[model samples]
Target chain A: MKLPLLFTDELRGFYKSKLMLILWIGLPIIALLFRFAQTTSTGQDIPFTVISTIVISSLAGTLSSVMLAVSIINEKNRNVYTLFLIRPLKRRELLLAKFLSVYICVTIASLLAVFVGMTTDYITTGMLSTKLIDNTAQSLVTSLSMLAVSCAAGVLIGVASPSVMVGAILVIYGGNQISVIPLMPTILNITYATLFTTTTTLLTCSLLLIAAIGLFERKQF
Target chain B: MSPRNFRNQFVVLREVTKKYGGLTALKKISFEIGEGEIFGYIGPNGAGKTTTMKILVGLLTDFEGEVYIGGFQVPKQKSEVHKLLGYLPQSVGFQEWRTVDHALKTFGKLSGLTETEIEKRITEVLDLLALSEVRHKKIAQLSGGMTQKVGLGQAILHNPKLLILDEPLNGLDPLSRYQFKEVLLKLSKGGTTILFSSHILSDVQDVADRIGIINRGQIKQVGTLNELKEHLAEQRTVEVLLTYATDKWREFQNIKHVKSVEQPSVGRILVNIEKGSDPDDVMNDLAQLIVKQKIRIRGINLLSPSLDDIYQKYVQEGESI
Candidate 1:
């Protein structure tokens, strides 16, 4: 189905919003703080880029999920759906647009933090290991996949949960548990672990997004 | 398909029925609307006016009805039907955070206008509705009338051939109501078939080309305003305004055709008739008695019953039946 043309503008507005702004800049600043604090306390310099990526990725995932849930739940209660139902908008497209916009924003915030922090770390350290660079790229890919999954979960909770409070509880307690486990696996992985995690996250996200779209399409309002 | 012939014979509701769980909101209600026609669908609250409008605009399709817009079935052809239809819901809210321009842009895109074309059309609709200055204002900042205008603008932004307005005049101030009426009239003149619902009778009486009055989920009356007024008049009733109020007015109780003499207010008396009362005889006798009483009077006059009177007459008659 064609992504609804109607929600693109809404997506743009949301992506540039204050909530996304804090996530984009604040995550990197948090990475800088972590490195500075670590240096002051332990006197052993931590890789600023690596810490930035981890912090930003985790924050992005959580923020994206909550933003998705809050926006959909709030709009639903406002009878905003009534406005589009009268027009030619498809429900599936609306759900997809919202998911994609939040996911992309969170991903951008993560990437910006990692790239900038990595550049600064390289300058200070004067050298980077090949294995570390490869690991960094793998971590970025995995984190993006995880963020996508969180976004899809948010959409699912939005579609399934009838109200914002319920969706929030579900997203924070219910969705985070399942999606977050993939990021921090208890099982030991010898090789190709990042690829396995990325694939599983993408699959989960796709299934959840499909389910969300179907549920939304069937909603009365 | 040519837009003229297309717009002319639009909004065909065939054997439409809506059942909510065990309750039937609408039962096999059907009507046809043509271009340049202001069709007023009036009824009491919960009389399925909103339900019918919802079906027409493809909102509530759980209905067992075939709503056709420009020859498109509502359910099977909703994608096409919605393309040609503009619906203003009874109570739909905008995202308060969005500016008027932003909201209109979203609505325009959803209505299938191209991006650049959507902007141009937004400008046109805003200017047409005199909302150009408020385009940048947030929805939270606008007045009720201005917001209603924005709602109306969103509906007509893409210039749909068929427009459905559910209680569009509700909660509007008098001036806003007049402006809205003019906007609807202008759209109707442009070959847009308007299917509007209102409970207020006088508003519809002024502009509606054809009226369908639904009561308790069924259409009780449908015709031109004059025809409806006449039909209700023919149904066991004649209204006689007496030239003067006198204790002698109690004598109307003695007349065979005078079923009941009711003093509605201090100056007005309603002489309700039985099943077959000769209106001519009733008026003549009433005038003769008033003249003989030597009562200082204004003038005796026969009045066509209004929609409110018709509603009271039928509702009472229906209840007693």
Candidate 2:
């Protein structure tokens, strides 16, 4: 009961946020402009899908990190957790609810951004291919999943740290680097981008949620 | 459900202790508050008042010992207890970007209020708190007093049985303060048991049916205002203002428990008492002295200890539990 209610409430708060709105529109706008400039310059064989991956990953990391860090730090400073805890709400449930809300919002926003960028790239080129659209969709899924990993890293830092600036730095900077776990040591072979994105995203998010709940449960307030 | 069903259950705190690393936040504290009773919890800063409040609300569960709210064990039945508890935390963030209406609607729904009920209560509470004009304003745009009122409005909107407010009146203006008191009194009359903690002596004295003083995590005293006054009677002192300074003889020099008598202000002097002495006795002795000395026309009476005096006696004294 509490988990769903909390998730709904948090979703309402996040989707209506100015930051989410900015990312949903502005990030794609920037990605489209960069792709347009690139196509005009080289005019060779640059995949808009690749550019979308780069833009979405970078933007999603920054967005998720700042969003998670600000709210968590502000809540910690103001003791918002105490209010929820008194309402039949468990610490773990609260943490999970927040993570779910932010992750879902980011996922939706990231998809929208990818679609806008892909549509623009297709429009500018006017050479539509079902194969290109499929690849774009596949790449969109990959980037969003990668962003999910980034968001999970944010949740961990948000719960562990006491300040927003510190948490933001740790998540945005540290998350982008640490999310390369699948690519490191050729351990996962970095084979099949879809598999890598799915496995890395789910595993990373789960671990972060665990650490967040553990720390949040033992938090002073 | 009948309120009487939980009448026998107030709050049962048994051997509850909270330790933070090396610092003991709360020692082994045990007590019970009866249903429908207003319990005032007072303590200095960092005295663990918030800690104890957190435990009762099921916010701090890593502590030692058991807490039962309405006869249901906290760790075990926290969900049931939460259904019955309305809590106002000392400081809470509300996302701050949404309109007051949106925030209230969400909180109301989360508290299990039906949509229609939430709508009606939202309007009624906003009007009651004189915040109807600003209902559409974002929380970030609200003043401290208005924000606090919003916090309180959300807590009471669902109408729970036990209302726990941690410094509920911190930012209210004088008028809002009175209005809040009126609201609380109305709720009490409607039979909602309240447990509020504050460092403000007068507010606690005004609203609480009983006040519990805690220092260093131990509850030193807990009772009604009159009962606490009676308990601290021994520390009570008498003050007198004479018409003429030199008119009264120094007969108080012979009175027992009359530690010192000094005319600090013109025509007025405070009569300090020895430890563990009654103000009544001091008054009776002064009356005899007045009769014997034929002191000039003046004012003489034992000062009934104010909540301030009582608070100082307990918290400042740092008495052992």
DockQ values of all predictions: 0.61, 0.61
How do the residues A54-131 of candidate 2 rate in per-residue lDDT, one tens digit apiece?
A: 787677766776677678887877766666666655778776777788778777767776777666667778866888
For candidate 1, the per-residue lDDT at A150 reads 83
Clash total of candidate 2: 0
What are the chain A TM-scores for all the models, listed individually? 0.89, 0.86
- Superposed by TM-score, candidate 1 places the C-alpha of residue B199 at a distance from the truth, in angstroms, of 3.7
- Tens-digit lDDT track of model 1 for B1-321: 012222465667777888888998888887788766788888778888998887777767687757778888887788888888887878768876778998898788777788999989999999988899999998868987788788899899999888888898988888778888888888987888898988777788766788887766667777777777778776344444556556767766676677777777764666777655677787778767667766555555566778788666655553554
Worst 10 residues of 2 chain A by lDDT: A180-189
Kindly report the docking quality category of candidate 1: medium
True contacts kept of each: 0.63, 0.71
> What clash count goes with each model?
0, 0
Candidate 2 TM-score, true structure as reference: 0.89
